[model samples]
Target: MSDDGRQPDDPLSRFLHGETGALVFVREVLTSVLAVALVGLLLFAVSGVWPPMVAVESGSMEPHMERGDLVFITEPDRFTPEFAHGDTGIVTYETGAAEAYTTFGEPGSVIVYHPPGSGGSPIIHRARFHVQEGENWVDRANPDYLPATSCEGVPACPAPYDGFITKGDANAEYDQVSGIAPVVKSEWVHGVARVRVPYLGYVRLVFSEAVLVQIDGGADGVVPAVGGERVSVTGSERTTTTGVVGSASPTLATGSAHGTPTATA
Candidate 1:
C-alpha cells in the first residue's frame, strides 16, 4: 500500500473524496472521458448509416411494438424485409421505388425518420408504399381505402412526393392525415426496426425519470427514495421524448453506409 494505505488503482473513490493527487485525478478523469468518447465515435463510424438504436415512446405500433421498448435499428441500405416470397437477409430498398414495396411479415417496412418541415424528433412507423406523381397505392392491408387523387385530401408534401407513404400500425389514418405529413424521401429515412427488448427501457425511464406516477394534481415523473428525497421530473415532455417499450426481435440493426446522424426518438 502507498503512504495513504490505498490501492493505486482506486482512482474513483479517491477522486470522489478529494483525496487523490491533482495531476493523478485529472489524468484519470480525462482518460475515462476519452475512452468513452472513442467508443462512441467508433460506433458512429460503423453504424452511422442509420442509428443503431431508438427508444419507443408511444403505443402507435401496438401488439407488435409497444411503449418503453428499446428498438435496435439497422441501416436502410442493409435492412431486409421478410416478404411473402422469402427472406433475402440483405439490403433491398435503397431509394424509393416505383413499385415492389417490401414488407416485414406485414404490409410495410417499420421506418424511423424525421419530417422535412416539422422540425420534430425522429418518428418510428411503417412505410406502406412508395409513390411517384401519378402512381396509385392500393392498400392490400386496407381494401376499402380510396386515394385522395390530390394533395387536398392527403398530407401536404413539402414538394411533390417521390417517396414512400408512412403509417402507424395502430393509428386510424396514415401519417399524412395524422399531421406528420406524407411522402418520406430516401434522404429523410434513417433506421428500420430490427430487434427489440421488452420493457428493459423501464430501467432507463426510471433513472432518467421518463417513467412517472401522477403526483398531487399534475402528472410528474418522480421516484421516492428512502429518506423521501425524490428524483423529480418537471416541465417537459421528455417523459415521452425518448420512449422505451416492448416488442419482438432477434438481432440489432445493420447499416448501409456510415456517417449519417440519426436524431433521438
Candidate 2:
C-alpha cells in the first residue's frame, strides 16, 4: 500500500503515472485547438482586413520603404476612401492580380498603373496627386492636366467628387492602358499609410523585383540566373493623374522639378 493509503497499483495511480491513454489524447486535442485559433488571429492581422499591411516590395516607393519595412494600414472604410490628393498609404485589391498594382501603406495602400505604351498589367505606385472638387491637381509628380471623370468603370469608382489617381514619382508619363479615365473607387482603397517601420519591407521588395524580372525575362540583367530560374531588374513605374474629389482644385507639380522627400517613422 502507498503511504497515502491508496494501493501501489491502483487504477487511479496508474493513470496518473501515464499508464492511461485518455489524458494524453485530451492534451493533444486541446493543444491543436489552441494552435488553430492562434493562427486564425494572425491571419486577420496581416490580411489588412482589420487595420493595415506590412510593406513587401520596393520600386518607386524606395528610400521611403526599403525591404522589410513594417507599415501599419488602416482598414478600408467609406470615410477613409476619400483620399486627399498627395496622401500616401497602403492600398489593397479584391484580386490577387490587383495586389501587383498596389502599394502597401499603413492604414491604406496606393495604386499605380503602367504607362500607355508599356505592355503589362497596371501596378500600384505611391500617391503623388489628389483631386478636390472638379479641378485636376498634381501633388508629387510632373505637372499635367487631369479630368474629373477618369475612373468610370474600375472597381471602387468614387461617386461624383470622390475619386483620385495615384502614380510613381519616378515615372515620366501617366498610365493610359488602365484607361485614360481610370477612377479609384472607394471599395478598392484600403487606407492611408500613417506609420512606417523601416527595413521591414526589404523582403517584399526583393520578392517583387524578382518576380518582375522573371516576367520581363531579365530585361535589365539585374537578376542573376539560377539553375532553372532566372532573375532580372524591373524598374517600370506606373503613373496615375487627373480627377476631382472634395472642394479644392487639383494642381500639377513637376516630377523632375521637385520630389517629395522620403519620410521615416
Candidate 3:
C-alpha cells in the first residue's frame, strides 16, 4: 500500500496515471476524424467537385440578394444566348472565369446576349459588356470561317451564334461600346449562382474590401463598424429568396449566414 492507503499497482491508480495524456490523444483523434468526415460530407453534398465562391461585395442584388450575402456556384456545360426573363441565375462576363470577378482587376466590357423572347440578365450591375449580337462582327484568324464574336463549339458564327452577355447588377448604365468578347463556350461559365445566404456575405465583403483593417485600433473600434462574422444588418429583410426552377433548402432560408448549416440537394 502507498502512503495514502492506496496500492501502487491498483487498477484505479493505473487508469488515472496518464489520464491527461490519454485525453489529449483521444481528443486529437476525434478532431481528425470529425474533420475528415466533414470534408467528405461536404464533397458528397455539393456533387463531386468543390466550388470556389465568396460573399457579395455590394447590394446590386438588393431586395433579393443583399450585400454580404454568401453565394455558391456551379459551372454550366454549354453557353446559350437565351435565358428566361425575370430569371435570377448566375451570369458571367466575357472577361475570365468566375474567380476573376472577386479578385482585383479592371472590369472588361461584354455584350448582353438576349435570346429571342427572353428577358435580360439579372440585377448585378458591376458586369462589363463584351459584344452585342448584331452590332459587332468578327472573322476567325484561321480558315475555320468562325466569327471572332461567336462562342466556341457552336455552328459557324453569325449563322447560329451562341454567345453570352455579361453585366454587373449594381451599375447604373449598360455597357455598349467596349467591344469585349462574348462567352460563347460553356466552359467559360464557371458556375451558376445557386444560392444566397444573407448576412454571411457581409463577412466576406468586410475582409476582402479591407473594411476591418481601416477601423482596427481606432476610436470607432467599439462602435461596431462591422468586422468578423457577427455583425448583423439593421432592419434587414429576413425572408429567404427561393430559386426559380425549384424550392431552396429550408435550412439556408431560415438559418443565419454565420451558421454552419448544410445545403441539401
What lDDT would candidate 1 get against the real structure?
0.43
Q: Per-residue lDDT for 116-152 in model 1, tens only?
A: 5544235666666556655444432243222354444
Q: What tens-digit string does per-residue lDDT give for candidate 3 at 195-235?
A: 45666544433322213322233222211112111111111
lDDT of 1 at 182: 56
What is the C-alpha local distance difference test score of candidate 2?
0.31
Worst 10 residues of 2 by lDDT: 249-258
Candidate with more favorable, higher TM-score: 1 or 2: 1
Q: Best-fitting candidate, measured by TM-score? A: 1
Which prediction has the highest lDDT against the true structure?
1
User: What RMSD value applies to candidate 3?
Assistant: 16.0
Local distance difference test values of all predictions, in order: 0.43, 0.31, 0.30
Error of 1 at 142 (Å): 2.2
What does candidate 2 score on TM?
0.38
Residue lDDT tens for model 2, 1-265: 6889765786556644553479767666666767745643563454333212333232334444432344443334322333422333323322212334433432224432222342322233444334444433333223442233344422223323544454433333333212322444434443344345555333333433322333122222321111011101111122121111100000001000001011111
